[model samples]
Target: MHQLSLLGTGLIGMFYTQSLHQYQPGVRVAHVYSRRKERAEKFAADWDIPRWSTDLDAAINDPHTDTVLIGLPNHLHKTAILKAAAAGKAILCTKPLAMNAAEALEVLEAVEAAGVFHGYLEDLCYTPKTLKALQAVQNGALGQVLWTRSREAHPGPHSDWFWDPTRSGGGAIIDMGCHCIEIGRNFIGKQVQPLEVVCWADTLVKPIDAEDNAVGLIRYESGALSQFDVSWTYRGGMDLRDEVAGENGTIRLDHWLRTGFELFTETGMGGYVAEKAESETGWLFPVGDEVNALGYVHMFRDMFEAMDAGTAPMETFYDGYVVNAIMDACYRS
Candidate 1:
């Protein structure tokens, strides 16, 4: 059994724990950790976890835990990952791995040197819609994936750290662009090296040091061009969409906004409508199952299965590093 030590009590951490418990077999979050004692204790209790701690090291070094899932803020990713690596624990970390390509390189090297199983927790790349699109590409339904685009926009991140550039590393480009860049990489192919990048970004809406809006283009060695558009100023709700084109055919996906299961409610939709929904009493796209729809279930399942079989999951720290490097180039451009 893969007993995991989850090192965050935030929304991401909850999704990770929930996915492991309900979706994956032979996997459980053995320990929960939070910066706050009460949150740590409450998270543990809510999830029926055996242990909780306010201490980062104590939580990571939990002997009962064989795997460490780092769901902490962007700034703390490197430290927690380094700690987990030192403990010889299998590590799974959320993106963008570190503050920049340099930090991401350090993280990548540490995990490689430790020779531990590492998976990059890029859930957007594993969504059901994305998986199906990738399959169609692999099956040659879409010929050569020459051009691709992915766009992710929402109000903004939930936590305060995101608003701080020093902590978050960047603004919308780093926050949501990580997802879009990686999604483009998926369609363009990972093995094919990215040759060039050109981008434009500005803090058009939010008053922050980091840019709240960005658009980037990457050219692959195979002459494929992938473009990404990311923003935190989008008002209506979260918009997750992607398009892929090839010599043979094309594929279009609408992940969140236009999901078939839609409802119009006069009164608030009881409670939560979806991840980034602004209104409860309107035409809403209430996700049937947020965890499953967001690809947490697929992601965790693939992670544990790969861990068990001693194989690499679809996403690794190296992939994260590549995406960070591309983001760095985009930011510089």
Candidate 2:
């Protein structure tokens, strides 16, 4: 069994640890670290972690730690990843990998230089409905992919670091919008290079330097156009909706529909509503805390297996760099 060390004890860390226990039983969270000693201890107790520490060195260098899962803020990602790489630990890092593309390059350089296995953690790809949508797009069930859109918005992150520009990067776009961008690129099988982008940021409630809302338009290398909107000011719970338009059909996915696809076919009269796609049992856990937790379960298991098989996992550090580069360009607009 591979042993894992987790950095940061925030919500993502909590859910990640829980999912590690629930889904990937063979993997063990042997150590945890946080600036807040009490938070580390709390997660240790809640998840039955064997070791907890406030020192980065201790957690990264622990004898039992074969891999490090970074759940820290955007700015801190570079520090944690470099430290783990230097310590000779394989890495599984959370999304929007760095403060910007340049920083992401630094992380990539460190990973390559250290000769370590690195993967970018993104729940967007692991979600059940997304998996189905990816299949539909790939199978040509949705022919001639024309346009796509995805949105992930929440009522601001609970962490103070997430609110700080220096720490969290740009805010809503970096935090929530990257997921949409990654998904769109993956589903359409296209390289997303923004031709023209326009973004507007707003500070709704948080006192941080980053924008609370952002929107952008992107043109893929495959000639597909996509637009996205993200916000930290939304009053409701986490909301994500995505749609794809094609020559023959359209596919729509929403959080409410769980792990199923809603298909619309082209008919002689007009667009005809077709059958609904069904997902396997336990394909998607309950939304909110449970949804996140389940995603990490798949995330870690795949990381471990890919490492053992000597293959890169679903999202590589390069993928992180691509998404960050696009976002950095959008921020410049």
Candidate 3:
């Protein structure tokens, strides 16, 4: 089994840990590090991890750790990645690799100098629906992909720090836009690189420095177009949808609304339905296994297997870097 050291005990970190436990028997969380000692200890005990620490170095440098997964804030990603690379640990980092292309380049250089396995955890690309859609596209069901559109919107982030542009980068464009942009690129195929980007962003709901809603368009080298919309002011719940149009056919995926299970509650279920579900007393999507459905389980599983095989996974730091660069350009536009 690959023993992993997890940095951060936030929402994403907790979800990743549970996913590893539930779906990946070949991987185990050996250590956990949180900013707070109490939180680290509690997470370690709750997840049955062997070690916990408030010191980042201790966790990354642990002898029992085979890999390090970073789920920290945007500004802290560079430091964590560099430390993990210096420790010669394989790395799997959450999305939006760095705050900007410059920071992403530093991360790229560090990992390359260390020659450690690295994977970028862009879970949306690995979701079942997305996978199926891409497969069909690859098989020429779409003929020639001419344009693609993807969106990810929610009321806002779970943490207060996300509101601070200094900590979390821009706003909705940098937050949810990262996912939509990557999804658009994935649907368009890797053979074509993004050549140009234009964006419009503004804050409408949240009283933050970052934009609450944003829209961007990307032009690929192959002359295809990718359009994306992201927002933090969206109500009802998390909305994830994508559309791809080609010369021969078209495909659409409504990730949240097209659920297999639904429940109507009068007094609420007294539990969670899905991520960012606004209410439990109304018609609920009631995601069966959110970790699996949202592709965290698959992401970790594929990452561990790729590390074992000494090969790059589907997504890597390079991919994350590209996404950051594109987002940087969009912000400038």
Candidate 4:
């Protein structure tokens, strides 16, 4: 069994622990940590973890902990990953990797230098609907690709750290855009080195300097022009959708809704197919049946299997780097 340590007692951290306990029977969250000692203790009590530590190093150095899951805020991603690497523990870092590409690269370098396995936890690509869409596209059902668009956003996150630019990265784009951007890359099976990205962002909630809404256009190396609308101020409720167009047909995936694919062909031949995305195949998480993969359990499971085989999971530090780099460029643009 793989022993895991989790940093940060925030919502994501709590959800990850719950999922690990519920879905990943092969893994155990041996230690739980928070900057606040009391909170760490409480979290441990709630999760029934064996130990709690306010000192990040202690958790990293814990003898039973072979894997470290960094669920901290975006900026802390680099620091925690680096500390875990220094302790020789494999790492599973939360999405966005870091506030920007440069920091993401630093984390990648640290993991490589330590010769430890590491993966970026970008959940959207693992969502059931997305895997289905990717298969449809690959099977020529979607024809030659024309463009792809993905959007992931929700009314502002409940965490205070989410509103802080220094802590959460840059609001909705980093909070949510990373998912869409990475999903796009996974769908196309190529790098999305944005030739240019134009962005417009706004802040309407509270007094934070971070943006609550953003719209961006990205040109990928595959000659695909992607558009995204991410926001913390949507009144229509949370949504995550990706539409891929091809010469013969177009495929649409609604990730959060778990709806199956909608294919529209040029000759007006269109249909809807219901699939669990993974039910028909022995595909693992991020590739097969939903299996109620809520928190990071599926992600960890995928990573562990990949590690044993000496291969990287679907989403890696490089994937996170590409998303953040695009986000940074959009912010600058």
Per-candidate TM-score against the hidden true structure: 0.98, 0.87, 0.98, 0.86
Instruction: Report lDDT (Cα) of residue 128, candidate 1.
Output: 94
lDDT: the better of candidates 2 and 3: 3
Model 2 lDDT per residue over 1-333, tens place: 889999989888866777777777688799999988888898899888989999988999998889999998777899999999999999999998999999999999999999999999987777766777788889999887888888877677777777778778878899888888888778667454556556666777777787888877878767887778898876534567888898889988776434253333333223212111122222222334444423555666677789999999988999999889889888888
Two-way lDDT contest, 1 vs 3, winner = 1
Residue 292 of model 4 has an lDDT of: 45
Lowest lDDT block of 10, candidate 1: 264-273
Screening candidate 1 with a backbone cut-off below 3 angstroms (N, C-alpha, C), the clashing residue pairs are: none
State the C-alpha lDDT per candidate: 0.92, 0.79, 0.90, 0.76
Worst 10 residues of 4 by lDDT: 272-281
TM-score of 3: 0.98
Write the residue-wise lDDT of candidate 1 on 1-333 in tens digits. 889899999989988888889888789998998999999999999999999999999999998889999999899999999999999999999988899999999989999999999999999999998999998898899789899999999999889899998999999988988998898898888889998999999989887898988999999999999999998999989999999999999999998998888888897767878899989987888888889888899988888889889999999999999999999999889
The parts of candidate 2 lying over 4 Å away from their true place are 190-196, 204-206, 256-289, 292-294
The regions of model 4 sitting more than 4 angstroms off are 257-297
- Give me the runs in candidate 3 sitting further than 4 Å from their true place: none
lDDT of 4 by residue, 1-333 (tens): 888999989877876777778787688899998999889999999989999999888998899889999898877888789889998988998887998989988888889899998898886677555766788877889676768788876666877888888777788888888877777766665643667788888887757888888888877676777778887876433566788887889887665434343333334322211211212223111312333433255576788899778898877887777788889998898
lDDT of 3 at 53: 95
